[model samples]
Target: MVSRAHPHGDDDIRLLGDDSFEQSDEKDNLISFDDTSGLRHRGPSSSHKKPLSAARSVSPSSAQDSPKGPVVAVFVVVFDAKQGNRIEWSHTVDGSVDIGGVEYKALPSGAHTVSSDSLTFKIGSYYGVAYFRTETDKSSARGAVFRSCGLLGRRLEDIVGFRTVLQSELSQGKHSTGDYHVLEDLVGGRSDFVDNAFTPVMERVNKSEIELMHDNKIVRDFCTLLGADIFRLWKCVLLRKRILILGTPPFADLCHIAHLCSLIGNYDISSPLRPDYNLLLYVDLNDIDKLRQSKTFVACTSELIYQLKNDCYDVLIMKNQLHIQDPALQRTCLTSAMEKENFSELMHDYNLRSSIMHVDSGRFDATEFVGGYFTALNEKILSAFHAADCTAEQTIADSALEDLSLNPASDVPFLQALANMHCPSIRVQRQPLCPQCHLC
Candidate 1:
């Protein structure tokens, strides 16, 4: 579950089966790495993909579905110096056609000082990517192909292994001899694409459809949530801004809870409109403006802390009183019994100290873990900013909401309690003391 913030950059370079970019280039090199043994998944869903009739030419006429053929679909993503995911490009290539011959080489790669344009993979052939980079300019790109792990006689790992080799062998200049695989020997030029040998079925991709289709697969799926599985990833994100409440048994009342929060005039977790102020921030899904503008929220994560680390966020790091599972694993490592109680009070204290904003995590019962924080902030947000805005915007928003508008019952027991207090602030604060001896 290593995040973009991995501490060992040099080590990553080495592990990616490449030496320092500063090393001299070799005329022919090879690094044979097959991760099929490491693959944990065993199936692919093919019901949605359209099948291609032939492997040589991609048929674009299957307009009802995304392009599908014998070729693998390669997705490209560029990263920053710290290796954070950035811009992306997607293309389709037959396994025998070579990733470079498809389309991307004619674009930004030639313009930028591409450090290395190589292929890497995750979980056998379920995912295959062609990575390219420009070190001096801090530009990087990747081409990814997706197929069911076991579909159309394609064993997941076998496809990944084949595609990786194709992308490598297709490089015009032979890779230098090193601690790497000499892929050129295995590759045959475009002429070898005939005879239906080592070909793939992939559909053509157009520029207009790329964003709605591949951006998430590259940016969010591959880049930010790499170590995490997609199921929980969807849940953590489905309710983007709200303090997402999740439980191990899948929280049967998720929608109901959201409804309740809305009725109480609290924020809705699943609402689509972007928040003026966000409380949960996904690594690649969010931008810099959202992070800097956030208030009260400190970096509070009980899970996947490493994934979010060292990406150059300058906010205060609040102390977490509890620990939880990494979000990438399919299931939570912790059970409900171990969950901390009175979480609300702790969140309130943390917010008072940090002036909080957003929270993002994939731990089991994530909502419960941060429920206290959300609850405390719920009142504070309503009482402070929302109260005024709601009243002002109600007239213009809708006539339906006018009947069910905000009405803060000014007379409450808490008001009497605060009025009876002698402090200038509305909330009453007591000095911290040891409960056992009643002294600090």
Candidate 2:
């Protein structure tokens, strides 16, 4: 049997040995286990729109517009004076579904260590958005109660609006005119609830609240930061390199960067040829064992000490510098410099387009623009080998590699591996050789 004191081991939240660990009345009484019949899926509304065209075309799973109003549950995680970190309150649309083990992920790993910040993290199938706040309250157990609002849902882009609403509700006082009274209408599946409560947020959701889908600025920043090294980074991720991103307190940026890295070189979201990136949003020393088990994964750490754990990671990204453990994978500064120059020209065109589009109602979505570059490159490699007869395929791949500033010696083999794996998906048919002679 596992010890209730440290069910998840020493790395868990500071709540392991607290007196309230064994007996917490609020935890038990707050959520009554009613049958699934009480739950009602709200009718579909125009308010929750679908993802961008490219995302929809890429995979149907990427676009999630559920009838359940985008959010399944809204909960609060507070740094308890006695219990360390605990879920103060939570309400789910499905009364029968229990929120278990998620309390550990609701709040970031080192949230209380900082004053205030926000982050979006993955917990199993559901994504969690948390905004931690620091307030001054003398009557409370401590001078200030560090409480965070966590929104859990399947639609990350759509439910982002709830973060602001929950923050407002928390500020207005969560005890008397608190969450239950404000959110009680949601349980009844009121048609007007989402429109009324999140009107202002709804208006801006498509434009700016896009997290995983398109957020143009994230792609811009990521591309600008990596420049030509982006190709090297893409290749590393495609080959399943162990990458660790280290940064300061607010890990939102780090987490986003990690996700971006995972997306790079992934031609198809649903491609079974390569598995989805094993992403560990926030990890610490306590998670060393878990890290060891993962063959290839992208993880973020706020602690600098992880840099010393050299054996765990093949690539270390810190302070805009990428340190590769393998000598053969060292940064090709010359090629990177040339790529940077080319990228600058590309950005000039993009900026001009952005300025002109700003005056028009139509906006430039950069998600496809950035992601397409890699897809096109991958297509070039695949087409080179599969579009022609097998005899000239080597020559074609080598020529394409040279054009992309890739090392033919190394990259040709990589492209060959991808071709072997994704030949059917990449290029459905190859040019067949002539029947009479071996050569076409």
Candidate 3:
């Protein structure tokens, strides 16, 4: 999606500069946005009363049940022509955790001078969701606008819900030291600032409470966009190869793809090959230095600058196509006959549920399916290695393989390669049934 005011159509675009900043008159009256509806409501002091159901408190039990609730911090980041992205103002839940470090992830890398975009990215242990907005500063000498800021939290949806309300407040010129108390309260697990409409349903994904909640549409779109290549991409992430995702503005989808890619490995495993979600929502030339030095990470960029940098990443995914620098990694996309059959079966089941089961039934979740596939795959590979003891003569029992959606012929060779890469001390003999020639 393009920015409402600054639409980016060109491959190469310029960004706003420091000359664009001219202090504008601040409006005293604050307007609060209704999260449930797009309508605007009077500020908190308005005598108008909301419905009883409209103003439910965020009880302590609700906050305790899931630690992901309440945002961590809110930041106002602005891009300077001279210094690049910088934080303008920030407020934390408890006034702890340094918000200055978030300067990089707060705005898209190589963002246009006047475009707007939203992204979700990881900063250390916290996840940040940001809305980048740029408007024409008519009073400025350059007529350029500046502002790209974010909301931080443990839950993606929660931060997003608050982003709408916060953006509304910012647009109204209510950005004062005192104006941030509502934001601080929201981050502190107080939802009284906004109505019940603002609350996002904190539903736990089936099978695991630890797994972060994801939008079905986002997962489905990513899977549909990649089609069969999703398997190859999954393997790339599983191997923790450096991956770069290039996309256009309103990089919300790309951010989701990067996030889902980051979840490839089992959390319990502490191997070097495990993929870490180093999700850089947007990147430009400034970010290239760090991206080059980084290990096994998945990052997204809207800047065309990366198109020239082939040496930096092992895999590049753009425009629904997956590209790999190494032919060996690319060849993994070729599926064996057994592997094809297994994928077909998984697809059939997925399609059946999509068509037969109603979405409201909650039985059909693409993220769950994809997540479960990887979880099972990780378990099977880990279990197989333990059972076989990395011996060339021992064959895995068919019963053990039955639990996996992938056939033995597909996972066995790949597992061996991964084992050899991560655990160099143990020579993982290839499973005889895999027949490497089939993959090549």
Could you say which candidate leads in lDDT? 3
lDDT tens digits by residue: candidate 1, 334-382: 1111111222233343333322222332112212222323333323423
Candidate 1 local distance difference test against the native: 0.24
**Better by lDDT, candidate 3 or 2:** 3
What are the Cα lDDT values of the candidates?
0.24, 0.54, 0.55
Instruction: Tell me the TM-score of model 2.
Output: 0.66
Off by over 4 Å in 1: 1-128, 132-162, 170-235, 238-335, 338-440
Better of 1 and 3 by TM-score: 3
TM-scores, all candidates, are 0.21, 0.66, 0.65
lDDT of 2 by residue, 58-154 (tens): 1223333454455666666666656566666667777644455455555545555557766666555676667776788898766777777666666
True lDDT of residue 92, candidate 2: 74
For candidate 3, give the lDDT of residue 424.
44
- List candidate 3 segments past 4 Å from native: 1-72, 79-86, 92-104, 109-117, 123-126, 134-146, 153-161, 171-173, 176-178, 186-215, 267-284, 331-334, 359-363, 390-413, 421-440
If both were scored by lDDT, which would come out higher, candidate 1 or candidate 3? 3
